[model samples]
Target: MESCDAALPYTLIGLVLRQPSPPHRGAASCPSRFLRDYASRATNTLLWICLISVTSLLCRRLARLVRLWVQGSRIPGPPSNPFLGRSKLIPGCGSLGSLTGYLAELHEKYGPIVRLWLSPTQLLVSVKDTMLIKEVLIKAEDKLPLTGRAFHLAFGRSSLFVSSFEKVQKRRESLAEYMNGRISVRANIIPSEIVECVMGRVDTIMAKGTLDCGLVSQQLAFYILGSTLFGDAFLDWPKASIYEKLLITISKDGCFWASYTIPPFWSREYWKYKHMCKRLKHLTEDIIQHCVEKYDLLSKIGHSSYKDNKDIEDEARFNDSILLDNMPSGVLLQEEMAEYLTSKEELCGNILGLMFHGCLATSSLISSILTRLALHPELQQKLYAEIIAVQEKTCKLDSDDVQKMNLLMATVYESARLLPAGPLLQRCSLEHDIYLCSGVNVPAGAIMVVPLQLVQMDSYIWGKDAGRFNPLRFLSEATDHIGTHKKYEDFEKTAFLSEPKRKAAFLPFGYGTRACIGEKFATLGISTLIASLLQNYEIKLQPGSENDPKPIMSDCLLQQLLSSPEVVFTKRSKRKTWKSKGSS
Candidate 1:
């Protein structure tokens, strides 16, 4: 027989206990039976609660697993950490703080279209396929490409570099009318004056015997820009020192990445960047004020009504008379300022945008080309020979003279291909989803990156020698049974000379309607300075320097040599003259 005492409560203070067993000899009263039923009911309810909780937890986990599987199936990418994504998987990416090498590795591992996660929320897709690049940059570029938050912070929302597509389009339309005329006029006349400025610096370098070509190139770049844009005022200003300070503040350690990712407000670098932006804003305002005054002076002189003149001769005379002492004609800067002059803040923003984009980008290009020339002494000699041949015929190295030097033009194009100032072109799918020829789909809010370095250096498109610097690839041979004709033109238009297959491969300035408006001006300025330097001196690498003779590229928004290289400049004496055998 079972024991009835087992069912009895330990304490029966308020009521009697009851047992649920057949009547026994010493059985408790009916109260015992009731107590046993109450305890049994309570126990069953507690067990049911636990069972439901465990079943709910298991179901939720299974749903999460299914979600991850679905998301992972849509695109191909390297293995990523669950939380960190692929942020740390890239080698030298964190320490070096560059995506160039990292992107190259990804392309090799996962084909042309590769997806990467900067963080859990930020997804990046990079493309190296040429046709896809065209589709993103040209065909589907309805929205302005997104510049990361770091750029937005550094440059205001109104800046063309970071502005929305609609706003940029409006600004571009207004600015184009002025820039096209100004660039055409400036390109023709500024080359000779720029040559003079470069030669002046070369004189100092020759006397010193050895100098930092990197620094010299930067100085030349600024001087050319200042003279053309600011006129006599830039000479008086501390342009070199100011430009250095701007670069230091803009590219300060941890600032760019921090501003974009998780801005460390408590950190010293962020505060410094904020302070720098303030200082730069004031400086830009002052520059604009000077430009306005210069414009007023031109108007007083009855030269303010000058329109875009297509006649080269007529424009040359006007440019010669007005553009004195390396002062800009002030037409473009003045007009842009007048439009925004009502608001000082807007004016300052526009001017700073022009200064940074125009000066910094061009300077990097100039410095890279100089470093390349210093390393290759034989190339310098060949370029010098070309310059001398042109000088012998023209008596003066002017715009027309420099334009005829095919080898010189080729060298510039090749250097640009090897080391583009802007390595990665960033865009965002703001308006609608963008689908590529490769069948990779980029959602509306996702960031799209075009790896120019990877595309331009691809062996499949550019041949095996693409990795090597050979300007001759641009020069095609027209061979007959008995003779050959060498072809050359302005580097900006040299794309036509390239084989039909490789026309889209070279885009140092950029592409599409929204491409750089100052391309002609910059190309003219760089070519002019280079020709003058080659005409005067033979440049070679210094014997002992910490930096390598060959430049090591670094990415800091723009691609520049990691360190400035030291170079020796030897002045050239009178040499035998040579006649051009064929037209370039």
Candidate 2:
């Protein structure tokens, strides 16, 4: 063996080139070759690791985007803001009646299944997609849930406005059972009492020939609600008017002005709210205490738990004492029986909701209907004629007689069309896959809504004059029957042909099994009040007004009540006293 250490570098190169080289058996292989091998292997491994990570990230991002897009593509939805999704375009959502104008425009744009925003979240807004909406509202809406802060921001969180559903159901049932037989005189005693207190002021105002409609509406609503619900006996309409102002302030803030008050976790609004809540709490406590005291004796006698009474009849009949003895207690017990409500806040929330619904919805609807009637004297005349026909036929106003006013029903439906109380009410999503309508499908979990206002006014389904206010269009029944029926033809789904459904549009009440529990009650109240009023005096708009007195129509369906465009009403002179032009 040759000891040629100096030729190692050259020998190594020669060996790789397959040339014969002098053997350097005396020197071991240099350590640098092993180091080089490791360096190359490490570099290749790092490169592969980086490549895989980048590929995985891209694939995940692509998958998420595809899912959202596929979910969106099922319905013909409007373009949404990339950042805010639908909220940037929806205008107002939680605010009362804001949904009306939004849905109107949405229907105008997208056919039915619209991508919308309720709280800066993607909401699939549909009018007829009940199956999906039920899942959201009844099934999943609470998953996110309402916070105490949200309730306080809207209604002092101290009130029952934030109450859970279970509580309200139980309380209402208990109250109902308790008052079943004992409330016989409650109805008559209250109205007469209200008249005694308010009629004088009404007469005074009438004599003065000037009226504040907003104040009047609030007063009337408060008095009516208070008397009927709380058994308030001597509430003068003037004092009731003040109460109305307070509630109006609260409602306007709660329903419309929420963003201004809400702060992260807590708010300075709480400072203001604290004072308001103290007063409200005291007032509410007083009323509740009074109700509790009303049947304190009964409570004492029947203080034992209802569970102790073994006989079913005794317990059932005992509902009266159980409820009247303690208003809150009775309500809580009843709600438990009905729905297992757990929250006290919800109890107050429901009461507050009642106040809101009664004051704003009922009164605003009344006002809106009156406004339309005032503008269209011909329609009024027709409605009056119907009223007269009913009265004459029955020889008096009665339950059966009220049912016969088909024209009245039509006019009411018509009013709902042009000036709906609210454009749309939401139902949360629940199910996985949902068929919105024919040829349109949403994925398993979806938000469905029966947007009657939007669906009814679909120009494609309803024709070109869908924007116009017409009542007669909805009244058409099948003069000629063909064997073709569409699944969802008219808003009401009046009838069915074979393939395409028969046309009878205009569903103001709502769609499906859970429409509205109080539709009949509301209809009765409005018809009766309007009938009674119109029969006594003619309602006319004030002439020669200084202001334009034009209504500020909300583009959004559910607007704040105070924002409701005001109209002036001037009662007409008695018809009997008016003289003929020539005769005079």
Candidate 3:
């Protein structure tokens, strides 16, 4: 039976192998059957792949949700929609003017610490509480330093403004040596000359008797910053008109916001911004190249002169010539900085970054002060008296002189407080979660906004007259009980300058290690310009313009854009007499 079974299996295999010759039915039928089988297999394989992909995606999302739940629930916030979050509900959410008002309303309704969602994936926690602000800005700053992908896109990743904390610290240390007290003293000598030149040009424009102070201040700021940073190189690079166009285009909110928030392919504004960036990059490169060539030529001349066996007197003269022939002190420092930093590209990025920052912020500050001064002639008189007193004490007006004018300093501080250069400071926690004093635990990758505008303008903190423009509020003594005293009825009297006991409550130039390095520079420049203007000109609102000079808060690329009313500049006889007195 076993032998029979083996023989049968062999016989069947032989038959199957040999039987293929008899299966030639219709050729078309065979091919159709084969195609059907192949299609069925392919369809099954595709279905399995799709099922696996869907399963993986769902698992990932589920895991993420589980992780969030395990971490802890978020803080109290306004009710949000599923996809849009609170963004759709906030009026003018994307527009700066409307955004400012909306944020104020949010704070009013939600208390000091408020939670908000920008989108389904993005969370924001805003804290105006002084204690919590201190904890966020000062205590755990290293762990939760300022970070913005948008800023990184606008300014290069290597830019000090967008760099990592460690990198920023290194750059700050390097820059401090050049921008410190001694350098400031040297820089103080030039503003007077620069301001004088700018005023001369401004006088011609104001000859028509009706002036746009906004335009005038912008021009003055550009020239001052240009000369200060680039020295004489700016004069040869491009006309003020070209620069104005470039700056206006570059500084527009549409340019930066679009680039920061939207994809270039999807956003027309972003594409335009990219083109502008390219143009700016080219312009800056040309400037840098010119500087390099000039430096090299001077270096060669210096070396050759030394090698020519010149006498000691000639050598000393050559040395002096080289120093005098060098680029502007600011530019020279940046050139030296190029060696210490990564590359020239980084230096250019930083230089342009500072240019944008100094030009816009300084001009806005000057405009704000001028508008305030014009609105209140009495205050203008007071500021002028202070400037006069300082000039009288010292034969010349310098940074030190500006510093001593208490009321002038107070006025500057007040303007900055009310309409800060940067109204909102955006920060993010990248490394770990942050726990606020209110016990609100913000998750990692969440944005934390320090509502500087709201915090500075809080009625509870600054009293009921917080909305009023009163410079005396900053200079008042903490012990002064003017808030309760009815007798102190005058605007200045009611507003006392209370020294800020809580540091976090006031941050015009930010606070801690990451504070604006150009604070002192900006302060010196603004103070010098204001002091000079007050000394030489009486700024008044144009006869036909608005009677009250209110700050028109416009949408800006970066922060609150302050524009002053149209005003006329009338040269003061008092200042002319003082100048003669100093000359005599």
- Cα lDDT tens digits for candidate 2, 201-267: 6567767775544444455556655655555422522244544565666655443334444443465
Candidate 1 per-residue C-alpha lDDT over 212-301 given as tens digits, one digit per residue, 9 for 90 to 100: 766677667766766665554555454546854674456443235444556678878668777887777777656645654654565444
RMSD of each predicted structure = 13.4, 14.8, 8.2
lDDT of prediction 2: 0.48
Off by over 4 Å in 2: 1-70, 73-75, 78-81, 84-110, 116-120, 127-215, 232-239, 255-270, 291-346, 382-398, 430-453, 458-509, 512-514, 545-584
Question: lDDT ranking from best to worst?
Answer: 3, 1, 2
Clashing pairs in 1: 17-31, 17-32, 18-31, 18-32, 18-33, 19-32, 19-33, 231-327
Candidate 3 Cα misplacement greater than 4 A, ranges? 1-73, 85-88, 91-110, 139-157, 232-241, 253-272, 289-342, 476-503, 549-560, 574-584
Candidate 3's residue-wise lDDT over 241-319, tens digit each? 5655676566654344544444657878667776776676667667665644655666577667676655643543332
Worst 10 residues of 2 by lDDT: 575-584
TM-score of each: 0.71, 0.60, 0.74
Which candidate has the highest lDDT of all? 3
Worst 10 residues of 1 by lDDT: 478-487
lDDT of 1 at 531: 79
Comparison by lDDT, 1 against 3, better one: 3
Of candidates 2 and 1, the better by TM-score: 1
